[model samples]
Target: MSIQKPGYKSLYLYLSLSMAPLFLAFTPLQPAYAEEIKNGKQVYEIGCAGCHASGVLDAPKFGNNADWLKREQQGFETLVKHALNGFNNMPAKGGNPAYKNEEIIATVAYMLSEAGFPNYADRTGVKAVTTASTPKPAEKPATVAPKSKPATATKSYKNTNQFNRLMAPSSEWNPPQSKDGIHDPENDGTEMLQKPRVAFEPLANSTSGNRVDWVKALHNGEINPRYDRVNPDAMPVVMDLNIVREVKGSMPNVVYPHKQHTEWLDCSNCHPAIFIPQKGANQISMASILLGQKCGVCHGKVAFPVSECRKCHSQAKTAKK
Candidate 1:
């Protein structure tokens, strides 16, 4: 025999025997890397944490197996459908419109896993099977009944509170009269003539003074009145002095609505000339407008007749105590 120094077959057998245990140790760990619950934690943190974290607005708290189990009994598919479509206070996709359906399912799985239900996939799979078994029949659309001809009653529908207030003929329908020569029937209302002119005087005086014509004070930049330009598009139609009297003892600066006047005029009608772009510039006085400076510019002439004292100074007509 030619002294073979350890043949190749013997070397191969020895190497295989040495590494067998190492291979056995890592084989069980392969599935862990293959199927990881991905982006589930991120989705939960951004979307579910808000209501679920604290049980806000009566939402179910996170990690509470009892709460989640109760919801689970409704079936995972039903719950998922609710989450996708929104149920009551819980907005759809938890109010994140951009979340994909796969992302939603993954997030639901993660939440279920965290709530001690690690076998979420098996449970959801069973739920899907059961849902598929009880197939619902397709619904037929409801047939619309033919519309009947409208009733010929002369009386209007009286269902609404608004109709109660407005539809009835006025017990007193007095036509408005003019001192000069301009009257519109559309403008013939107590609010247009009386309420607007009267209610806002005290609020005007709180900022300026009694002698100052309230309308002139607003136009001349004596009082910096703020208004709501938002919904219903509020303007200072008339300022109620009672509002001034209500808060005047505690807070000295409250202006009333000269709101109604602006309904007839444009923004440029009073801006720049009446109010400075830089706040707190105009200093107004009653004597100034009476001499035709600030409010006197229009109040006694084109806007309304300011000669009537009771118009602005009328006290709240108290019931005889």
Candidate 2:
């Protein structure tokens, strides 16, 4: 007999390793019911309070039976469906998708019970109970007198010439530059600063009417007007200087930034002249611009294109003559 020894060390190590997982599996997990309800309440206050509290847009008011009863008539399942899909003004899931369907149901149930609906019950299985008791008032604290410290002396300055100094004119005062560049004693820096500050005046009455650049607008898919011909290589050059001058009237001729336009748009965007393609062509007019046609095609539609007189005409008002 070779000492008839039992080989238990290796077996013990193997059994210990196997039991580790079993021990972990049986460990008790703490309940999360209280924490879940706390979180649910916070979520409800932020997302549901807006419409539910005020009954906005026919929303069921919080703690109100009449409104909830009307909604419940449709049945609980239908109500949950409505909450998920959203009805009329109520955005789907109250516009917040982070809420779990279970949480929504639980919160709705809580709200129903709070509103005096007897049928509502806590799905979490927790019940709250109250006990009545007499309350006592808080006792007041005793008062004590405060000790006073000796006052310290402060230095004072006096000048006999104070009145004369007040009457004297300020030495920093300077005369203002007149309209002619010559300095005038009558008008001073005070008058210069008092003048109103210059402000930006938009070309049009409302920026809403202003149009975007044509090519840029087309490139942005803003305008989809028909084009007579599609020329990839062709750019939006000034078709004629004379036409621009006539259309602009008394205002400075807008140096149509054609290169800037072509960069963003295709020829088809403004081709056939913002009108149907006819060889001799259709007449583009100021009336059309106001109506959002031709130049109005994009001025207000997508590009800074408009026939509003003030937009272009008023530029001279702020310009240095």
Candidate 3:
């Protein structure tokens, strides 16, 4: 009907043309934001929030930069794989089977964001930065920052050859780095991977102070030289024996006799230093022991060769059954 012009129609046409610039301005930003994933946060809240939020089972706290900084050095990919496969007490997908891989990746990104790497995935391209430059959180660990050096740019995590994975750094910052932002783990002026493998000299002494040695000496009315020095009168010292029950292993269980050790060395030697003296407190892995920690301190160095497995594992095979 070609009658009088409708005011509302003119108004609608005028508004649409005037607002065209506004639509154009937001068009480019869509992809930038659309690519940035927040799905990880959603999944984390539903699946991982309970444990990670509060650090249950020593789970890295969500926003605790100090807690996640060292772990983040291992690379985002490694973290995702650990989540997919399951790490220690955490089940795969945080025990939620419904989560997808993308969700897990997003969850990891969310964790990194809270740890100080805001927009971690987009900035790092889901890869570790090729620098020792660590991101610092607004709030930091309660302890004082390293007085020796500050975070630098340029470090590599390519080696991935850490022998011990269970133990993470706590309350110490050694600054395992050089001025150029290089981390030579050996500290011997060589690259991480270029460093020579750990070497051990041939067994210097086959005798690892076995039970048999102690028994034979006692039967013949002789005592260990170290003990002999302590007790010249041949009087036995009163011992508060603590029998260590070894968990299942490749060899027979070991029955650690505290009485035997105390006879030669004082309580100070092992208490709170080499051994924590608490049940299950010591994560004594054979790998670390061979590297000269725990019993390896004296066992292989001076006392005896670790080759003498039967020395500590005194229980007969038949008895274990």
Candidate 4:
């Protein structure tokens, strides 16, 4: 016990070791402001990434300084206003009305910060502070569910030079038929007709197409679309089957779910008429579909557009062992 270890501890070292806890206790730690930044990143992925990631509809690419700098030239407040409100081809809050003002601001800040513009959020005087003493989060809005409509594009389809030409933009989606470009505004009866939104709100929602999950809505008893116009009691001959069409190259194989289609349409709508019942009897391709044949007969017109490739081409191709 008398023989000490090889190393010797000085009196100063002992004192410093004893005070280490106090030193750490008095030291300042950064606030949990990263929470806001993380939320911003999440918001971008959920809503903004769809267009921004790929620069669809001329949206600024995520990390592109050139595109972001031009927008940054506009005052920060002005940029915030544009994001909060609709601007050009981009819809407000990237089409999700559910996004909070603070969240949107945070997201824009995150984008700008990541794109080589540091302290952009601070420039606007909005503090991104979070701490243990922070209050409970605000209660969510009563309209928690997404509105049963996609964001109406500001640009008309006729004028848009982008891909996915099927979707047209309108200031007022589901407007009164009289005001709707398709219907004659002079027709008094058109105005009397109920707005499409009013009828659609109750249906299950989707991100694309008419924004109504018509199949799910039917299954959930929200809508009972009559199979026959004259005979209201007529029921569809629902088929629960899937046909997987193998695609060339890296794209996933197409899985055509008959159950979804049959819930609304009869077999006669396709079998023998459009898609021949016999396998390999019918010739199907993207070219033909774009020409309004095969699946295109309904997809681009009534069902979800072909632009949503993952919806149909869902089956992953496995490597040969």
lDDT of 4 by residue, 1-321 (tens): 122222336434544554575555432121111233224666677668878898887888888889899888885556666676667776666665445454556677777876778866442213333321121111211112223322222211122344633333444456667444356555677778888888998999887777787878988999877788899898888789999888866889889898988878778878889988987677676645755788889888988888888999999998632
Candidate topping lDDT: 4
lDDT for model 1, please.
Answer: 0.46
The digit string of per-residue lDDT tens for model 3 on 257-290 reads 7766766677788888998988888766454455
Clash list (residue pairs), candidate 4: none
Best by TM-score: 4
RMSD of each: 31.5, 33.9, 25.7, 21.4
Residue pairs that clash (backbone atoms under 3 angstroms), model 3: 40-106, 40-107, 131-154, 131-155, 132-154, 132-155
Residue-pair clashes per prediction, in order, are 14, 12, 6, 0
lDDT for 144 in candidate 2 is 11
Task: Write down the lDDT that model 3 would get.
Answer: 0.53
User: lDDT (0-100) at residue 296 of candidate 2?
Assistant: 73
TM, every model: 0.30, 0.30, 0.30, 0.46
Model 2, 148-202: lDDT tens digits are 1011101001221235422222321121233212333245663464321121121
- Tens digits of per-residue lDDT, candidate 1, 193-218, equal 65332444443342122334556666
For residue 162, what is the lDDT in candidate 1?
29
